[model samples]
Target: MLSFNTTIRKIHLWLGLTCGLIASFSGLTGSLYVWQPEITAALNPELLKVENVENIKEVTILKSVVSLIETHKDSLNKIFLPYREQQTIAIQFKNGKTNYYHPVTSEFLGEKSASISFFENLLNLHRTLGIPQIGKYIIGTSAIIFFIILITSGVYIWWKAYANNLKKGFKVKWKAKKKKFNFDLHKALGIYFFIPLIIIAFTGSYFTYNAVYKSALKVFDNPNTHLINQQKNKNFSTLNETLLNSNEKYALRAIYFPKDKSGMYRIRYIKDRFIKAGYRKTKEVEINEKGDITTLSDFRFDSNSNRIVAQFYPIHIGEIAGICGRILVFISGMVPLVLLITGFRIYRLKKNKGLKKK
Candidate 1:
């Protein structure tokens, strides 16, 4: 019978082979997604940027929303407030299309372009392998395997090195043969980049198993926290008034106009710092046409689990630390592919040597 260490090595090798393709795909696409915001801005500068930003003032939120409704004849699903003067407000419609308007001029630029469509497809492919519900579970399961391999193999590598010579664990034998070099590169890179790689795997798993994360949050957050208010009236003008009367400055992120008599206007916004800073703080206000604040959710006062859940996406994509964080995540995504190649080669060489000895 194989020893415990031998069994774990087999498990790690097989797991890596099984999930290698999908995991590599996720890493490659995730690297691209890290710069999605920048790519979007570059692809559609006319829609995303503006000139004379200094001279431009904030447009009336209610007026712009009303104009969108009158022109499109579609219920306003949400309004994305620009984080910067050069950025444009995105008015999302019930039809699942978003129209970009100059925040200063309120000039209609255009709908989402092919580039945005391509990016969306890329995201879906990354998350679901271009497959829907079933693919998500597969990815989630693979993520768990990744975490297990990281823990088991990582400890084993260091422990075995320590048993041989304590210093061997830290030093790469550059003058060694091809196989030794490969082994050193794999072990060294794994140790050096372990933290970020583990983070990416854990968070990416959360995205794949979001239902599990949501259920876990129920233990901390009030069960009724997500339930929508039933008292909806079409008096959004009053809702707008209440927002205007508030002393605090807020940049709108999204506004959900009531769909029926029972639907409430759910407004999500941010205050303090640009939205590009991952909007570390956010406030969600749900109110009826009567202008009564029916429900208020603020990240500042949220429970610990709630806060973690809210920050999960930003943390996963490295938006929390801005450009530097994104670059780290992008590089981390590529490490697994390197490990897979080196690891498989090592396994093949070991298997051939064992056969020769037999």
Candidate 2:
């Protein structure tokens, strides 16, 4: 019978082989996704950018939205507020089309289909492997296995191998024989990048198994009932009131128009310091036609569970620490591919040696 350490090694090896490709695909796609916003803007400059005009008043934005609603009517879905003067206001329609308008003039510049965009496809593949319902579960399960089983077992195998010679675990023996070099590369990279890999995997799993995380966190027992308010009203003018009434300290991020008579207007806000990479730090509010504003969710004032939940997106993509963090996350995504290659090489070499001995 194999010893406990040996059994763990076997488990780690097989699990790595089984889920290695999935993890690699996810990592590569995730790295690309880290720059999706920038890349999308670069690729569609005419649609994304506009003239850098002076102070765009709330009345101007309201007029633009009202004009858009008059033409588009009930098809309008959500309106994304421009982050800067040069950025165009994006209005997404129920028909899956996103039309960009001049922030100051409300002139239609261009439009794109959500289903056909390159990044949209890439995001779909990353999240669900381009498969529908079951794909997310598969990716989520793989992430869980990667996070829990493979990482822990791999660490144990490494510790068991290098407990006596700890220094060897940190460095790759580049001048050594092919098999030894491969082993060292695999072990060193795994040990060095394991923390990031674990974070990425955990966050990915958190998205897929959100209920599980929330349940584990004990946040579901008493949910925030005040997050959304449903009523029978559709007044486009309320958007202007929402804009005017909004806190001037917080920069408006986006405004989600109600879909039906029962829906309420939702507004998103971000602090000035976090304007660049503030995915998790945003504050959301919902307003009815009566101008009764309800605080939906704010990261700064959220419960511990809610705050942790909000941090998952930024942490997963490395937006938590801004550009430097994103760079680290991008590199971490690529490490899995390298580890997979070296691990396969080592496995093949060992198998070949065993065959020769036989």
Candidate 3:
């Protein structure tokens, strides 16, 4: 019978091999996705950005939306306001068509389907492996298993090295034999990148298992009071006035127009001027046809649970720590691939020794 320590070691080895490829793929894709915004801007310069635009007037944005409304009518689902001076306004239709217009001149730049974008497909693969119905569940399960492997491997590493030499566990033996060097490299990389790997896996899982997250929020007394108004669509003549009034108080980011008659107009923005527009800093509000604005959700005034939930995205994507955080996350995403290679080398070394003994 195998000893308990040996059993755990075997478990760790097997688990890592089982899902190592998937984890590595996820890491590589996630690393590329870290720079997606910049890459996308570079790829679609003319469609996403404009020239000779100094400042965008509020009335220009209003007229642009009204024009789009007149053209698309009730088919319009959402309008993404330009976040920067040169960026164009983006509108999404209910049929999944997205179009961009100049924020200053309201000139039609281009349109594309989300289904065809390379980055969109990359995101889909990261989340669901490009599989349709059950892809998310598969990815979610792999994340759970990957998380377990981290814990188990961490414990095994500590168990083996703590009593002997904790310092040696963290350092790779460059002067040692190939096998010893591979083993040390694996251990060191795993230890150094463990926290980031754990964070990425946990947050990725959080998105997939959102139902459980919502349930946990309920336990933490999150009110979740942002229900749809369910009223019929009224004249949108007051929309421009409502937007202008809100813009005076908040830095508007995006506006999600009502889907149908029952849907309310949802506005996402940041209240503090000093705070950069990010998932953590953003707040939301809903506007009824009567033009009454209601606070949807603000993490600052929300329950601790809600605040924690708000941090997940930024933390996962490394936006919370800014550029430095992004760099760290990008490197962390590559660590899994390194670990897999070193781990396989170590396994092969051990297997050959066992065969020789037999």
Which prediction has the highest TM-score against the true structure? Answer: 2
In the range 86-179, model 3's lDDT, one tens digit per residue, is: 2677888888888888776667888863422888889899999998989888888788788876555655756577658878778888999988
Cα RMSD for predicted model 1: 4.0
Candidate 1 C-alpha lDDT tens digits along 71-186: 66535677776663227778778878888986655688999889878888989988888876798878777777777675457667567766677567667899999999999888
Model with the higher TM-score, candidate 2 or 3: 2
Q: Give the per-residue lDDT digits (tens) of candidate 2, residues 268-320.
A: 87664222555556677788766667777676556566768887988998987
Q: How should the candidates be ordered by lDDT, best one leading? A: 2, 3, 1
Predicted structure 3: lDDT: 0.74
Question: Given candidate 3, what's the lDDT at residue 117?
Answer: 85
Candidate 1: C-alpha lDDT: 0.72
Candidate number with greatest lDDT: 2
Candidate 1 residues lying further than 4 Å off, grouped into runs, are 52-63, 73-75, 83-86, 163-167, 173-176, 214-239, 242-249, 258-261, 272-279
lDDT of the candidates, in the order given:
0.72, 0.77, 0.74
